[model samples]
Target: MGSHWSAASRARALASATRLWRGSLSQPLLTWALVLLTVVASVAVVTTGNWVPVSVLILIELLGAFLLRLRGMVVLCSVIAAECVGMVVARSEAFNPGEMLVQGVSIVALLAFAFHREQLGLQGAPGGLMLVDLRDRLAAHGRIPRLPAPWRVDSALRAAYAEAFSGDFVVASTAERGTLLEVAVVDVSGKGQAAGVRSLLLSGSFGGLLGAMPPEEFLPAANDYLLAQDWDEGFATAIHVSVDLSTGEYWIVSAGHPPAVQLHAGSGRLDIIDSIGAPALGVVSDLRCVPVTGRLLPGDTLMLYTDGVIEVPGHDVEMGIDRLMGAAERMLSTGRGGAEAVLAAVRASEGDDRALVLVHRDQS
Candidate 1:
């Protein structure tokens, strides 16, 4: 009876988490996948007339705590508790008291990796980036009007992310009808006032050309703005995208930037969106942005970021891209939804100045 009750309780809790996060990604799909796998293993404790697998489930749950913040913790405990209860009730012939005790200690040890506090002392901060809270001061320019009547963008971080001013401005824009016009996510090379200035000039030129110029000419317009500047402080990497929301089709031109990854929601497969184009902005006058086109369905997401997310001291660019692709594939199998969850997983493992912008359509 006790073991049966335990299984019932564990099943209930897992069901709740599944229902709550059904619509969107609540955690990294990897973590969720592990949780499900372990839960299935625990259920086997009852049917197989064995409880040995529960020990394995506990270890997997503990490892999960490292990948995700709080959800991992909850799922780990729920599985252990469910097994404990079910063992008492179903009184499965497979239940081994000695092994269960050992597994319990191991589970505690695994959870230790995710925590700062131990009986002896505290752990080092896990996240490595020296990030600034660009919240109060660096507001997205919602009040200001950017041309291109269809898209709404304000110059919020034009100074820093654009290059001239660090944490100086923000361009928060949206378009009701972005059928023909292009949208871009760009990254300045690195830190300092010079990078800030470069970011600003890039943002200014792009803002100016958004409504009028053809998508291909926008980067050149930005380059013209970069050359007009008297100072030669820094360069930037960028991806300019022309997306047709109506048809879920997009044309992307890569300019010496990290490749973007596209996740098709209907089929959790990914396409590496990469092409050889011009050098980073501000360096070349006649840079070319090689374009690639693809179609997306509702819930499909594409992510573009700088080198910060997967940088290696060695030029293991191919390896880095592969790791990111593997992570995305793992996330999809767990049934977690959306781009933000994917970004969170990448950031959790990142050791640099990570920035990501995702484009996903509303499913309504």
Candidate 2:
């Protein structure tokens, strides 16, 4: 009976979530949150014939409405619905429509304008809960393989904390010609929409440019967006680049990001790219620095990485570029993972949240 009741309750909650998720699907997670809340409220009514059951639920829904995006609210609603519906169905009698209506209406009125998230009074667990849902949504999309493939992509959060959705997102889109277009990656300083919005802005503007323009043009475009956005100092550090497989041409423009590597096709010699990267795109007015370029001849390779790859502290010095380069050369010579070898080296150096992206210039 308990299992059956749980299943029915979950089904109703999912239905509510699906309904709202489709309707306000733009913020599916938020919508699910709302649906779940409704289910919880309904179930409370059936369970205790009292307001106590849904009291906590009402608070959660209100928080979602205020703190989370519409999609997040939808999913959250679905969850609450599942719980509430279960309790309510478990006790079918003594359901009072008038009392429930009043409670619902009162909460709705308290919400003021149901659509404005910033206008909400969400804090603490409520705020965190919304972030949690958004994080899950992002994680779902961040299906990074256990190992590297010819084709790959990513958009993972640093932590699963709902409040920490926007950290560093990386995506690798394959080109129609069979070569990877460019490995697009982003690093944002903080969480919340402020951080997420910036990350999104960079990803869209830069990735869009990568589709049409060459790497030389891509950097300036990313800088343009960074300078244009309303971000304070210290909120930026990213390297966006594209590796051309056919010609062995590699282009990169960085603002406080780790440099990528180019290897000698036959000798196993690796060279750290040489170019004055612009300050983290947003810091300087208009950067005079040119985009860095190099070659990865056939049988050669390139390795791109974020700061997380090098930020591990050793003794007292942070293992920055010099150490990274040495590690790469050693790995390639040892015939380890080659272009992808430095990752393991860094991980073994210290598991300091390393995210490495290696592109080898080999004919497919």
The TM-score values for the models, in the order shown, are 0.50, 0.54
| Cα lDDT tens digits for candidate 1, 187-210 | 766553535445555555566566
lDDT by residue for model 2 over 1-364, one digit each (tens)? 4433343454455456556544654454545546655665665556555655555666776766654554455456556545544554676464456545654564455444443443453322344344444444443333333323332232223421334445556654445465535665556675444566455555555555665665556556666777777666435666766656555576777776766666675887777775436677677766555677777666666666666656645532234666777777777655565434565555533322335666654534
User: What are the runs in model 2 whose C-alpha is more than 4 Å off?
Assistant: 1-166, 171-180, 191-197, 233-235, 313-318, 326-344, 348-354
Candidate 1 clash figure, as a count: 34
Candidate 2: residue 277 Cα off by (Å): 3.1
